[model samples]
Target chain A: MSERINSAWSPSSREKERAQARKRISRKQAVVAAVSSIIVIGSLLTIVVTSPGWAVVKKTFFDINYGREVFPTVISGLWINLQLTFIGGACIGVIALGLALMRTTKSPALTPFRFLATAYVDIFRGAPLILIILLVGFGVPALRLHGISSNVIFLGTVAVVLTYSAYVAEVIRSGILSIHPSQRAAARSLGLTSGQTMRYVVLPQAIRRVVPPLLNDFVSLLKDTGLVSILGVTDAVRAAQINASRTFNYTPYVVAAILFLLITIPMTRYTDRAIRQRTNAQNAEGAI
Target chain B: MSYVLELSHIRKSFGNELVLNDLSLSVQEHTATVLIGASGSGKSTLLRCINLLESIDDGQIFLDGVEISDPLINVDEVRRKLGMVFQSFNLFPHKTVLENITLAPIKVQLKSKEEAVDAAMTLLKRFDLADKADQYPDRLSGGQQQRVAIIRSLAINPRLLLLDEITSALDPVLVNEVLSIVRDLKSDGMTMVLATHEMGFATQVADEVCFLESGNILERGTAQEVLHNPKNLKTQDFLKRVHQAGRL
Candidate 1:
């Protein structure tokens, strides 16, 4: 109490933190400025190119304004990519949680179960994913093991789900172990059943700590979904490639690149903010 | 006299090293007994065995005239009747003070949440932490949190309350707060068994004080007899060191 009184400065002498915070430009203005800078830099290049009569340089991004003919296909392609990512990422998350629990359970009787899950992870993560896609897409029907038929898109979906869940499992295992043993003890001491303690006490804190890392995994899973298009899934990336090949125009590749950015850019920004906020919390705790 | 709890010839060994060897004591109903000893003297372990927090390899523990250490005894039922507070003030960090107090009553006892909260509120108010009802354990002072832990145990309305060095973790200034709450508990006719190094707490609140060395109860009697004129040389030496430490 005495220390606080001594540390306090005169009202007029203190700097206004809010006023200082207000001095930085807003995010909207920063984006506006960046876009304008790109335009200015492009026009400078165009001016230099046309003056020199360089044929290849003459069609700078500024001089060549390809009309809005490509807009509809590009927009649809981005929408398809977004939908694919959400579906694939959700499947990976749901499967990863079960596998992570399998990896950590200690019962010797459940050893077979644990080994099977581990083998699944090791095989998918170790092999080339492209081969796994072809094997699932082609081999299943040829084997005639059951009534299953050849479904390329279904097989592609299965391949992506299998590949990403292993990495997600590791992410989840770290989350569960990060909780203090005392937290679980406290729950057990209250006479809560083992499962009840896990569900109510342990998982809540562990899941909170893992959210940012899980978000990172989810975003990565979304990006990996584009690989599925190679297995004839007709996803955004595949559609763009088909159009590009047919017309022999480079526009489709550019369109696909934009499609990727549309999904990845916002996802990256959200996870970045969430992770930074958590990191800053850790730093504050260290300061204390 | 009908005793609330009796541990006879209790022997516990963790591998080769014996933590408690033939330790025995009887606790009377509504009486406060304090166990005093140096570090690693098995005083805490002996107290923990009564509540079955730690199992005893040999010997018998009887609670309320019923043998509790028997193979047929249901430990969960025994634990419901026994409440323990730790030196570390093991308040659930994620829970509020009131919720920590109310959790076991609702969860284990199957009492309605409203009924449990009412019982918890009384303990919180008695501990002068009613205002801290919604505050997390980490937000409270060490003394306040320890008191909350004590109140949390008390809310369960245990027939026997075991306090294992409850005030040792508190600051010097905060020690008195916890001790006074313990003293108040005794005055209110609560039956409690405590393990403490503070000779003065033993003198002020305990009806019987036991001097422990290694795993044996070296001496036990009325607080006045043990505190003022102990017969054992070890007891005298232990109290002398306690006094010197307090002075320092």
Candidate 2:
């Protein structure tokens, strides 16, 4: 009986043949993938390089020396974009959390605030980001508010924070709503006050569920900070605009685009990984 | 004697569907009261009403002889003295077993973190769940999760514990583990009101068994009197059906 059990557990010659067949199929698949990718990408590259205006296009957009020369200024300009994103992102997180809580609150004391939050989300989310930036940038300065600085950077940050807060708030609210009501009942039954329940039980879970969406907004916020360049904040896009117009070469524009991609692509990959990890965590045993 | 819990003419409705109609019951201190009936028989609603989870449309509830059904009463304050375990074992998925058990003690009762953790560890150890203290609910079997939930409610030292079909969601193999904890709690003299479909378990644990039909307790007696020799026809029919279904 022991011998039979061991034999049953061990891999047989039939199993070895099945494994060999699987390896053969996988090898064939890899070869096919490589051949198709090489053919498609090589043809596209050839078409672009052999175009009639390739010389002019390469000189204007792909000039390595000019790109190297402008890199420092554009990088310094990117420092401003980075500052805007971090500062604006922090402000948006706080404001959006407040808005989401306000919208979801059942307290009669917050009735007016809930109405205001709903209206704010509708207005800002419906309007384009650039339009809000232009309005707040030029409009706030025009109002000549005493305490508020007329600095385009400050004004631009405010506009970005305001618009992004609305979008992020909706994402957060959806997460809150997605949680089963039974969770709230359990918390409440434990004698946690409604506010405590929201703080301890609901918000922690809600915010966790919305992290990937929040990261997506963060990436968009980084790119949209370039929109502040319109207000003459000298961010990466504006710096590229200044350099490109000065030489009329357009290589600086390409350089700035590449810089933005350098940051965004990794963030996008991280967001995808976060989403996959969350899905796996949900399905995996002992997941925290 | 002042009762641990009392419901007088409690009436509740959800959008024209009457769930509990003029229902009333009382529980004595340190006694286990078991409610048994078929589905939609108002056993769960009565328990919910006692815990103040469901607002009474018209009635009075007295917890330890205080009229808690008054509209001006703070429901949260009342809930602090009562513990409830649900049919689905609604353990907070985000929290570890120990954290789930300690949450109410730390937050609601305002116990020191060390004190709550000590109490939680004691309960978990006693329940054979000390090893699962750091595991999330999804990592544990349904029985283990339900045991943790019972421990969570006990951490607050509630005067009255309300259990709404606590073992209804567990598999047959898992039900005994969960029911055994309640058996232990009964022997330890915990005041409890539970609705269940387990007739054999009810006979073992209940000091009093109430048979509910629609929204009324049609029969009330000791489990031997109620389960084995029910007087009301509805109670007998319900028991016969349950027995035929192999649940009794």
Candidate 3:
């Protein structure tokens, strides 16, 4: 009678003993793996330095300009690409929300919606983004639908949204479904309608779970906007390409790459911090 | 006593399997009746049927003498008057206990937030958990959360309480606290129908005890008569096992 349910979830005596033994075994295994990995990495580094390639790095580091002057055009183009990436990411968010909601429904009325999402993702993600922009820039007027004005920037934005929405939709759906079914039941039992349940309980939890992935998607979406250069959208990559054409040097891409790193580095740091926070919370509860 | 709730000849099926067969039950105003039976005895199904949570293929249910067969009967209205406590507390995890209690009153019933909070505060206090009113369900112990759940249901000021194994999830030390609260409700004369395996509580406090087996009522009588001198063999056998389990 001494609070029997306190024992409800705690493991029995045997389980506790087994868990302790397993921890000891794993700790020993971890030490062995760490020692092995250090040895292998040390050998590889030594072999690389002793090889002929070591001289090339020394030659380039000394002769080449370690810090080249930043070009204004490259900086301006980098800014333009940032704008396009953000704009494209925003559209992905809205479309992903819609597609995620549609994926949960079984109604025949939503068949076209499901099919369209599926088809768009397959077509663009299957073929490269370069081809999609080429099609949008060339195919629309080529089909002669007769005087339908198409902007390259708009077309690039649309192409990315279409391609990324399907992937984002799957991420969001998993987030939504990961929520305990009890949360929905509690909302319903409290007299909130199904729509209210989704809006309040389901969406809040889903959004929290998807935040890291959403940030990752945004970082990648920025890189993917480089493909819009083929459509002549004048984004960062396109501006770099224009500069590279004029200078007859690939050095312009290095500028665009730096800008891309600038954008993604902060996001990666934030993702790591968030993951640490989440794991810390779980481990804290586990300890309790 | 006038009947506040009644179910007549209810039958429910899932494909080929019949779950509730020709089941019928009645509740008098301001009296607690506890249903006792083994697992698969359809006790939980019967509770769901009472609230229309589970649809019965063939049956009629009446709340306050108004039949619920017509499409016009608002299920929400019936549920508002018949508070139910589930085995799992099922409190909204994201919401604090005060918000959990006040949500229905403010949103569905259209009461002002101030009014709903005022009412919820009283229930939280009565459960001796006023300090926990701002805490989420996950922050509370299982017993404390279950007690909050009971109070949340009662916050609606239901005409009758339907408890489905209310104390089943409780630790042994916390079981009496819940049962004591239930026993105190009897003094207030709140009408109730409890589905429970707590034989001692059923024998000591219930106005009537109904023994159900396989979706049918095997025996029923006043608590004293059913516990002390059941005439049916199934009832006697059930009592013997119940006692051997140290529950009688």
lDDT of 3 by residue, B104-155 (tens): 7887678999999999998777778999989988788878888888887787
Q: Residues B1-248, candidate 1, lDDT per residue (tens digit)?
A: 99998989999877887888898889998899998888988988887778676789999999988999997887677877887888887777667888888878887888999999988887777778899999987778889988998888887788988899988887889999999998898988889999987776788888898888888889999988987898999988987887788721
- Which regions of candidate 2 deviate over 4 angstroms? A1-10, A284-288
Residue lDDT tens for model 1, A1-288: 335565666545235665455555576688899999999999997787667556543332213233144556656755655676677778888898888878777768879989988997788779877787778777776887776756766677777778888878878878888777656555555666556666666676667778898888777766676777777776667776776566555566665676677767898899999999978865753311
Give, for candidate 3 chain B, the lowest lDDT window spanning 10 residues. Answer: B68-77
The residue ranges of model 1 lying beyond 4 angstroms of the native Cα positions read A1-75, A101-135, A139-151, A247-251, A279-288, B14-16, B47-50, B65-74
Predictions: Cα RMSD each? 5.9, 2.7, 6.5
C-alpha displacement of A65 in model 2, angstroms? 2.0
Give every collision pair in model 2: none
What's the DockQ for every one of the candidates? 0.31, 0.70, 0.30
B211 Cα displacement, candidate 3 (Å): 2.0
What's the TM-score of every candidate structure? Answer: 0.79, 0.95, 0.81
**Candidates' C-alpha lDDT:** 0.78, 0.92, 0.78
Error of 3 at B189 (Å): 3.0
**Could you tell me how far off, in angstroms, the CA of residue A206 lies in candidate 3 after the best superposition?**
2.7
Least accurate stretch of 10 residues (summed lDDT) in model 3 chain A? Answer: A61-70
Q: Write the candidate numbers in order of decreasing DockQ.
A: 2, 1, 3
For candidate 1, state the interface root-mean-square deviation in angstroms to 1 decimal: 2.5
